[model samples]
Target chain A: MSDVRAEAIELRDAVVLYGAHPALTGASVRIGRGEIVLVEGANGSGKSTLLRACAGLKPLVRGEGRVLGFDLRHERAEVRRRTALLAHRDGLWADLTALENVQVWARLAGAAPDEAAAALGRMGIAGPLASRRVGSMSAGQKRRCALACVVVRRAEVWLLDEPHSALDAQGRDDLDALLVAARAAGATVVVASHDTERVAAFADRRIVLSGGRVA
Target chain B: MTEPLATARTIAAKDLAVERRSRVVANQVLPFAGLVMVMFAFALDDDAIASRVAGGLVWLAALLALLVTVQRSFAVDAADGALEAIRAAGADMRGVFLGKVAALAVQLLVLEAVLVAAAIVLYRVSVRDPLLLVAVLVAATAGLAAVGCIYGGVVAGAGGRETLLPLLLMPVAAPVLIGATRATESAFASGGATPAEGWPWVGLLAAFAAVFLVAGAMSFAALVEE
Candidate 1:
């Protein structure tokens, strides 16, 4: 154990499985505050499994991990509160406008309006589009709405899976800026991306998953 | 307590907003109740029979209102991705359930009043005691929403919800409907069976509400995450 003083996420020989097959086997990683970590692997290679475990979405089938000092097995809710998980599902109300989506999440995450709006606006997602129904928005724009959800939340850790999949060049640039800012503000951000070009640009460190363990 | 209440309020407000946007309660429920009332009028063609049974008719309308509304309330959450969002947001499912129950309770109350009023007008029925009627409405609506919220959460993730929802719900809600209608009829007949005589059934309804509310909260986490 290399005792890092400000470790945000620490997974120790953690194993997670879906039914019979193990997704993560003896996987161990430590992420420190203010670090931008990238998790990369092929499909079915446990990238998402690791991210889901770290975010407290899926329980570890074996071993131990701690998020924000809350044991993954015991203090699940505590870990969930301090971390935000954004998956392929935008998790926004399609009937709700972008601002309403952010506002709903902000309240759920116990964030203030001014802070949330500033976070969304900083990413250049603002104005009338904020109030337009997400169902009415384009794919890239909906992705931006999901991004705004993460920014508005006051979590110290973010587990994002393929956040840049549908974004355009400007959208990617904006996301990169947001990730950098999130890291700069002492939030441990773990992004799972198959896109090497984008990961190379913003990732502070990269962990590659082969088989079911970190390669 | 404050956070849980705030979370509950937020959940309630979000559901209300969606309902408002789509005019689900106002548009879908009112017309559905009206249709049921018209059907009940034709189903019981005897004016004397209809007048004598107006309370049960209205209570039946309320149950159908619950059937129509609770499923859609949860379906809306599932459709709008609100359920997944709430889970991802770390909300207490109990609070979320209570919030949904609260919203549904209010909507059910409004719909129940509509049913009661529409039944009175359409069937030319008279009320012996209005306040007692409202009390029955409150107790019955609470029970309905509580049970319906759980079934709603259950069916929210299942396939063929249209077929599964009623199949799962009717058996569970049958007791509530029987108890509510019996309580309402006894009260309306000016019989000695006061709301107190019906207290046991009311207590059953309240206890049932408590059980479902807790179960809804605990099970909600698993359901939404699924």
Candidate 2:
């Protein structure tokens, strides 16, 4: 088996569509280890769709791409197993406490949290609310809990879709530091965002998207 | 960081623990399942119909209970951003699907136990072969939960989860329901485990579970992101 550590996400003429509506044109790029790439575009400009394509979340209904050497069409599971994606909604269980929420993803990500509290602590989520149900959390707090998921899993690649949204200044700084730490650890990072100012310091290159085409 | 079994177990455990703490399953689902069964019993009361429909009654209770629980399964994960995180962390969607199915399976078993116990007490329905009946329960419940897990993903993405869930789930679930009801009827009629007569229906339920599970697990990542 090739070392998973050495792998990178590669996109070549990758196209994605929702029925007849094209979300990504024949776009191509490669993201390598230790690289922090920023995907900047207006809403519905294919920033999210690009991340989805490379992660094998979006099907390459036409054209082709390789993520960590697995063809997006034939080996999606292999591609997905090596990539981590964060999205806009902070998709979480409102009924679960912040700690339980992260623990669930940690388990699903094949990471066991000996102490979920410790993970929460690292994400700057402490005190009584750490155990509070997600439904009661502020958007920033929920995003913090969502960020804790990456810490627990510690995957090689991170595809963050608007990771800085709904955060106050402190939360943005914390996330920036987290992204820096991830890159220092040799993890590949990609951030898709319209808020370029918040993510600028961490990017190795900025790929701009407009009208489903790379600009 | 952990083995897949441990990971799946933890995901299942977290959901189970949270539900236990909140008593959501007991408060919301258990009563509803029991009520559905009792309603059926009352509708079929004081007639030879109760005994005739007992098998269908059990299958019906399981189907309804599983349908309700499956939506809860995805709703919990989707709410916490846990689904996106799991997908991001590159956890096998199959493993995640299995974890969801496993959690729902446990919930279904508990609901089934309550309903079955209630059936015996309230309706005076009795199984001639307790062990064989337990086997039937296990097979049929697995079938229901497996199909439910897949449609749960589809319903999670739809606009109306509560309305859409049963719509998507029932069509896929019909084969298993029919098989389980037929197997139960045969069991009741024969008063024994008759493989020649009962196995085909049981086999159909088993096949439905196997086929959908593989298809569901394989197609899960696609469905969730869409």
Candidate 3:
């Protein structure tokens, strides 16, 4: 968005292992800032694994990476602080009001309360709905709330796994618009999903995974 | 740069708020603590329990309640990846550790108070040195909460964290239990200001707390990552 194309993510032969098994195998990928990339693969094919690695949620077994200029190996915390990862789990506290979930996270990230409320409004969750516990909400609503957290965080990069799973048509469209808007605001977006048809309209690149490597 | 305590305070607020809303401690752990203490009363009769085991019973009940509350704290956070959100925010994992310890400590303190009240009422345990008892209560519960929170994180995602936590925590907690019970016994013997007599045990509790607090804070980021 700033007319600056910088390397936002750089992974060089990065290996990620879970116990004795390898989840990602020497996969190398580069993504520039302000870009929206879709990671596509079947279950256990390392789509989520790669996103987590980039999020600093998972460790690399071998090779190297740098996220937003921080070494993935040594300064993973710095990368994590700058990114938001919406994993398969919605990550919202079921007992907390939807608004509390967003605001607490926003405040934790040092964002203003107004920004949290605005993020909730952007996700179509305000008023009474915002005060309701997340456990009582529908699956789609929970996903939306989680998305609100990601948005409210104001992080530099967003790593989402199957963000469209439970959303309806309208929700899906809202997400597409939100992702595009986020990119326009200069945030890099990497969404892992198999349903490329739904997100391809806004995705700048489509990277496929096979056998843990970027195929 | 954000204030270090800012995120920790936010985390503590969120956790405490959730507990308040859910009443998990009120409806579940408090009752569990009461039930355990009540059963202790039933098992040993009034005289045998009151004179011999009141302090140990209270300590044991608080420990059980601490175990449950600590695990529950992590469970709620881990439920929807809230823990991961905290981590990814890079919002001072040490704060995350301290925040959780603070929440669990508060809940455990409440449980201790309830257990103490129950001990006084049910067991007729006289308070000669309520001061020493109170000191042992606070220091030992702090140690228990800190240790429980750390192990709670360690087993957060494990296959059998539920069972693993107690085994891992209780042994480490034995010193706290022993020191607390011994100190309380001494205070009961000496009466007011008798806590000075058990200062050595109190020191042990404080040392245990410092060890685990530092360890938990340092390692929490790694524990929750997986």
Candidate 4:
């Protein structure tokens, strides 16, 4: 068992259910602060659920879990406040421009307004592209916009699901660089992705899940 | 921690911005409401009867428009999981509820104005008490928007939300429809009623609005979260 004080994420026998069916059976994981961990598994292997559980987005049916010293069961709002979860869906308003979308998220996260522009620029979405509506943008552009929103928040824990699926080669490289910078900044990164080879170089560790338990 | 009121303001501004860009309310809901009033005029086929029932028709049009506005408001969030993202980002859900109610109320008020104008032009109804009419419009629109948002959040993310929203909203909204229509009839001085008679109904509308607004604010987080 990892020392609770040193860990950024710790889950013990966490079980999550969807109605009567179990999505996460008895998963347990421990990662120290500022570690970049890649979560791998098959289609129904509960990889996404593990990341969500760490982010406090999924309730633990039967286990003890904590992220950044916040209890997963009771202090979910605090966990959410300190973490950012990028789900499969980009979670952006299609009608809003990329800049407007990032600005709104930045304001919600209480970040400085200039951070919105800087984040977008960091994601390679500057100039006219920033003003373009998300509905009109290509899939890769939209993904980059979504990444900008995530970047602007500057959360301590980043739970990214399929973070590389829609990005082009350049966008993927940008994302890799962003991850490296995040680690250097002392943020914990837990990414659930199928591209193991791409993430293998920088990921400090790999945890595979099968039937909802860590394998 | 972000102040809840500030969060509410930001969300309200964002929602309004989305509406301004999408034009769904202007292009779709407003025309649908105008068309409903025209259809009512055609169905009545007599100026005397249409004028007699103009207040009821106006409120009815507002009710239908409320349904469309509520559905469209939630649909935008549901389309991209924006609400989930907002919640997961630790936004105060009560603020979200209030912001949505404010935006929906604004949209419904605009729809009511057009419907009232349509009633005057098509049904030849004259407003006997403009103050009473305005009071009824404000209170009724607030009540309608509150009720619509509560039910809208409940049914959001469900399959068939488009159809489920009306099914769940109409029955709950019956009180708003009845209260607004009766109060508006008095405002129009239809059926020999006076503006004095409408004050009580306005009180009822205000009470209904207050109750739902508080309830929605308290329950929105639970309703939206998984």
Candidate 5:
């Protein structure tokens, strides 16, 4: 009823179809700016779809939605610019070094070189480790490097899917702090994770999805 | 320049830089083109190959190389989710398409230059209209890059893309192959067809480039979207 302008993400009866099958059906959600929201759902429950939609990676085939005051479909590109989605794939190039990967993201987001370096530092990637090719790094290290990319972006919205899957204990702790920091910095955070308890302490709200609708 | 253009430049730089590091185009495609030229020389008499068949050989070599290079453009990005990351960055989709076209066009043009020189040397082809040959090369390369970019995006996430791409690409590329070959033929033809005949084929090549460049830019977002 109130102004949807200020909301970070607003959706009503949003539908995302992959071929004939709807991955997200009649989904409705409202997340305010700077709030940490967690999406809990089973494997086929459309957790990734919801996050992807929020980041404007998945377009709404039906219904209506707005991400950061931009239409979820028509203004999808703009929405994606403001939001960052870290999916199951770490999205790191194998031939590129950790620093190069982070730098690429920083450049895309128009962030400064120092900021990218600092983001890597925050993720505990430095010295020789910073220059190591992503393929050569351990899975946890690659995850950390990718998290560093998210950190450097400093986007308005953060959409993370299965954020804790390949993370070490320290990496998980760092991720938790990053979520808290992003929220405190006035960025909306939506995390889709099966390990809900790990992020529960910092989450401002919890949403559970079943059959593509809020349960 | 606008942000999209800047982003496009960055993407192009990254792609070209990667190719430089990998040497895929240099070591693999370039040599492949040379070998194809040599094999053509072996099969056809040099006297016949020089003026008459040389154009066809050059186009065929470039076409094969285009298939490999264009496929790599998407393959590298697809593996790392770099394409997804780019889209998420909110860089203009058109800019992404243009950036790739520019990078691939440059690489292709470089390959074209070398192959043309090789055709001239190995086959002893003389240029009646050097300018026309250059024009055909430029226009054809643009068409190839634009069309390749579109299909590259289309097959990014699809399975069996390595095999799927040539099947999807070769048919559509027929116009380019015919147009470029004919244009090249008319360019150096002493009496094969009037030089005027070559201009129309060049026009066709230009039309192909323009049509596909616009199509790729308009449809790029839909093609790459998950």
Candidate 6:
């Protein structure tokens, strides 16, 4: 495979701005295919922005980027189709049950309902919990449901921001297992989180961001 | 079904399902519209004047309720970053726009039915032609929903979306209000008007609906993305 195809994510001098302030200032990064990479940063350090840039949710104002061989600036929709980003917000319909939320996302991703239910089951949300409305679920439960959504997406690239926050011990372990399984299956994973000790053992490499640049 | 059409159907169905569970339209918006009609009845105490102005009053109430319904519709998606998630999932943006418009149109149609019933009873107005009235309702609702979705998406996640939506939507929706009111007036045959006079206005409403729907679908991706 060519170098571009060998690397799951490649960024060169990428700059992403929120208004006039630069969230990612001329940052460059590379992660090989099937690698589990952890991105560490302090508050306002642009960790989330880096993950979003890889997911094609944020546009690069000044540099070149490619995820899974699709150019970030020109092929954002293609990148988005092959990647999933789990951010701080659960991204769920509050009025719908957990099962319904995952099913809707599954259908949107062209996955079967059975796959959605199985994802939820893997996240430890089953039976009554799956049937309960997301609005009433505890924060950790909601996070698990959101993870279920990420699971059902079946993307080639996983861009997760703070994937561990709001999860119980079991949920955290489940998430870690999920990440390991994803890497084993050849899905590249980029996670931005402050909880390094938890992810350090399994992460293939670690990169830190300071003031929007790789440090 | 084609992928885009199927995606649109799923989005529309999901929206309707959320609305059903939340009951925001049924419990809140519908009651608010009914109250507006009631207030109009009280303000225009004279039966003849109320009947004559019923068409304008009904459409006016719908316009105000359109603002509320659209706000509620977008709020559901904005509340938990659902729209962002869907967009990042690479679901078709045009499909998303159409689904939202379809859901909003369905809710607005139901609201219009209630408003018309309230108008007939409260204003003591008689319908000259039911078919004309139905055409006016469908076309007018489509225009309202299309415009509402466009402006709603524009302000979906903004800090001042509540006030911003009305400010952005009301001025642009003036044509819809005028067209619907005039067409409805003819439908009721008030002031010596006839159903034939409303057909042209229905055409205008449909045109407005088509233009806004196309524009909204094409621009929805940019509007929702950062």
Highest lDDT among the candidates is held by which one?
6
Candidate 2 Cα misplacement greater than 4 A, ranges: A1-13, A30-32, A61-64, A68-74, B1-7, B45-48, B79-81, B159-168, B171-225
- Stretches off by above 4 angstroms in model 4 are A1-6
**TM-score of each candidate structure, all chains considered together:** 0.92, 0.84, 0.94, 0.97, 0.90, 0.97
* Stretches > 4 Å off in candidate 1: A1-6, B190-204, B214-219, B222-226
Task: Give the alpha carbon lDDT tens digit for every residue of A1-215 in model 1.
Answer: 21236478888889998658899988988887778999998999999888878878778878899987778887777777778888877777877788888888878777776765676686567888777888898888888888888887767889998999789999888899888988888788999998867877878899999877889
Steric clash pairs (candidate 2): A84-B88, A85-B88, A90-B81, A91-B80, A91-B81, A92-B79, A92-B80, A92-B81, A93-B79, A93-B80
What tens-digit string does per-residue lDDT give for candidate 5 at B114-133? 99888888877766788899
Best to worst by lDDT, what's the order?
6, 4, 5, 3, 1, 2
lDDT of 5 at B165: 90
Judge candidate 4 at residue B7 and give its lDDT: 81
Tens digits of per-residue lDDT for model 3 on B1-226? 1555776688788889999999999999999999998888888885753656777788888888888888899889888777777777778888888888888888888888888889777877667777777778778977887888888888888888889989999999999989988787666652232546787888888888889889988888777667
- Residue-wise lDDT of candidate 4 within B1-226, one digit each (tens)? 2667878888888889999999999999999999999999999999889988999999888888888899889989888889888878988889889989998888888889989989999998899999999999999988898899899999997889889998999998999899999999999998778899999999999999999999999999999888
Model 4, residue A159: distance off in Å is 0.3
- The digit string of per-residue lDDT tens for model 5 on A71-180 reads 88788867877888898888887877898888877777788878878999888889999988888999889889988988888888899988888888988998899889
Q: What digit string (tens of lDDT, one per residue) describes model 2 on residues B1-226?
A: 3455665676677768767766767899888888888788778776466766777777788888787788777777776456655665556567667777787888888887787677666666666656556666777788787788888887775788999889888987888878877777666553343534666777777777788778877887677765
Q: Assess chain B of each prediction and give its TM-score.
A: 0.89, 0.89, 0.93, 0.98, 0.94, 0.98
Residues B74-143, candidate 1: write the lDDT tens digits. Answer: 7777774657656765777777878888999989888888887787787776566565676677888887
Candidate 5 achieves a global lDDT of 0.86
DockQ agreement of candidate 2 with the native complex: 0.45
Error of 5 at A103 (Å): 2.7
- In model 4, the Cα lDDT at residue A70 comes to 86
Q: Which runs of model 6 end up more than 4 angstroms from their true locations? A: A1-6
State candidate 6's DockQ. Answer: 0.66
Better of 5 and 6 by DockQ: 6
**What local lDDT does model 6 show for residue B84?**
89
Model 4 iRMS: 1.0
True contacts kept of 2: 0.68
